[model samples]
Target chain A: MHVLRPLYVVLALAVIMLIARSFWVPNDFGTHEQGYTYGWYRQSNVEEWKNFTVKYRGKEFCGTCHAGQAQKLASAHHKDIECENCHGPALFHPADPLKLVLDRSRELCLRCHTSLFYPTSQRSQIKGINPDQHNLGLECTLCHKPHEASKPGRRNR
Target chain B: MNRRDFIKLAMKGTAVVVLAKGLDGIFRPSDVQALATPLRFVFLVDTYKCIGCGFCVKACKLENEIPFDADVSRTWVERYVVTSEGEVFADTPKEARNGFITGQIDLGRGKFKDIPREKIKKAFFVPKLCNQCEKPSCVQVCPVGATYQNADGVVLVDRKWCIGCGYCIMACPYGMRFFHPVHHVADKCNFCYHRINHGLRPACVQACPTGARQIGNIKDHGDPVENIIRTQQVAVHKPEYGTNPQVYYIGLGEEVR
Candidate 1:
């Protein structure tokens, strides 16, 4: 009889815990169907996305405000590059035009972009050039792709 | 075209003219022979006109469509401010839609010092970009043949070929290269070759409200653009590195010390 009573109490507690998890036992009830809950959901799923598809194709966000500057970047293949690639997440600004977030660094470009650090992509083996001894202290974008091809003859734009 | 004919032509040609041309060799070695100096392209950044705006920082973002936390900064501008007491301040670079808003400073307010007489009368904005070198260290240091120096003198990396090793990152004297999170490879500015090849200035130059950064070819003698560099006392970042950089800084301040 004693063992049966203990088992019954244990079963009752398990059911209560299950009920608390499913229903409103403070933690679950606090965020139930609220904005805070949805916000949390967004935070968890944000990193899974790979590509950012804009409603207007090729319309750079920075260009909208700085038209003259935008025209310069678009003069060549740079036009194909998406605006957010170097800037970071810009979702808040589109809805609120004045709310702008801007940050930049050469390290950002030198790090992940394989094309800026290596010599050739055709070869299987890829390695980083020690920036210290090779070209003095110059960055790749200075002479190569700064706006357009700026080459003496074969310029793209 | 034969040596005998050339000798005859030389006899007819003025000796003084040839020697004058020969003296040209002593003065301007690069112009002495055609194809003597390799045809290399380079960029020059004029530091004075920078309004301390970070438009280039933001444009790089949209053009590359990079993530917010992305470490790659294709182009950027930094503000150097100094007070009479030798206090220096620099603003964080940003590419906001409104322009560089990282850290705001006002000369009128004189936050650098209290007394107006004691306040710093000289505070200037200096912009920085990739100093495409005549001889790129990144190209030579690349072990896998991934980073290359182009005919125009600019060094570039192939994204498809690069491995995320980051030897270049450690080797860079200016600390330009970075390792991206998603792709996990080395990346940096290509000087917007996509646009420069198209015959346009970079986004930063275009967006600059004060023409602080000027882009031009160093070899085009006929163009008036060459004067800006020739007449100015120019400086490059980390000249001790012996990179022979293309980007030049005019009127460098002692605060650089």
Candidate 2:
């Protein structure tokens, strides 16, 4: 009878814990077939993360409206670069700001073009110049037409 | 039949039934289907091709809504300079957003000194982001169960549930996690989960003009990135930790940790 009393107490405690867990834990808190490899978590968090909105809409989104600029850019040396890199994010553009401001600053151009010699790496392959010696205090766009890369005798070493 | 014989027969019947039920569970068709096509995402970084232009860093900030002026970044490029004397120096000034202009080496604690270009025997840039390991220590150490790896293998944080406990940030072997300035929760790269789900490249991958960064679904049969990962002799960071990092690097230098 004494041994049986301890067993009865444990049984009662288990029942109480089961009921408490049912009330405290959320309905969606369990392992699902979808993400079963990783153990239990709030499954709805997966959907929340998946549904996050993307701000950078890529160059294809820009090409839809700016076909002329896109076409010109495709044939230029800067073809690989996305238009949004210079113009900033076009989040609901034409509906909000009506115009995306263009950054024609030399600093923008120097971000890639400023020479820092790294002989062992492939970065040396890029045509870089010492910013101080290469037309200091002047916007690169003033002398170079970024979109029109085919222009003869306009290439800078 | 005798009582003992009858009892022995009943026990045999119960054992046979239980074995059959267990076998059915093991070979369930739905379970097999789920296992066959589990999505595994992998990222490849070509260290040789990375020019450290920092466009990726700038683009990631704008895309993810992280403040441009913020010191922390989701992804950043580090420049390594190995001297002829076997000394290694590394720095990521402004998270490589402005690009590497000067030859200064960051010695930490608001101190900087220039490394003479003549002493530099080898130099390269390595772009880094969250490894999104198979066994992410961040997920394991999260006291609130806020950080978890999704079906597609990206480790994500439930910002709402996060208690701002820095356990995860400390647990990460890669030092990838950081405190979100605005949300005050642990934040790290989810491999740009939001964009990748929509068939779009991650902001950093898209902004990389040099094609140094790439990502792909390893489960897919003909993915170019996966093909490269399979065919090439790729290396991962800190393999000794046994975290099973998914990020692969090509032409990784000995100087890179």
Best by TM-score: 2
For candidate 1, what is the total of clashing residue pairs?
Answer: 91
| lDDT of candidate model 2 versus the reference | 0.83
Error of 2 at B250 (Å): 0.4
Per-model DockQ: 0.01, 0.40
lDDT per residue for candidate 2 within A1-157, as digits (tens), equals 7879989999999999999989987788765443433445787888888788777788899999999999999998889889988888787887865888898887777667767678877887777777778878878877788887564327543
Off by over 4 Å in 1: A1-157, B1-39, B68-71, B93-118
lDDT of 2 at A42: 82
Native interface contacts kept by each candidate, as a fraction: 0.00, 0.55
- Give the per-residue lDDT of model 1 (tens digit) for B1-257: 99999998888687878888887665443333334333445555655545444555655555455555554566655445555677775544332333332223433334532223235446555555667776566655766545555445455555555687888778777766767666767766666555555554555555443455667777776544467677767777787888887877775666553
Highest DockQ scorer: 2
Per-residue C-alpha lDDT of model 2 across residues B106-190, encoded as one tens digit per residue: 7789998776778888889999999999878888887777888776778888887889989999988888999999989999988
Each prediction's TM-score versus the true structure: 0.50, 0.84
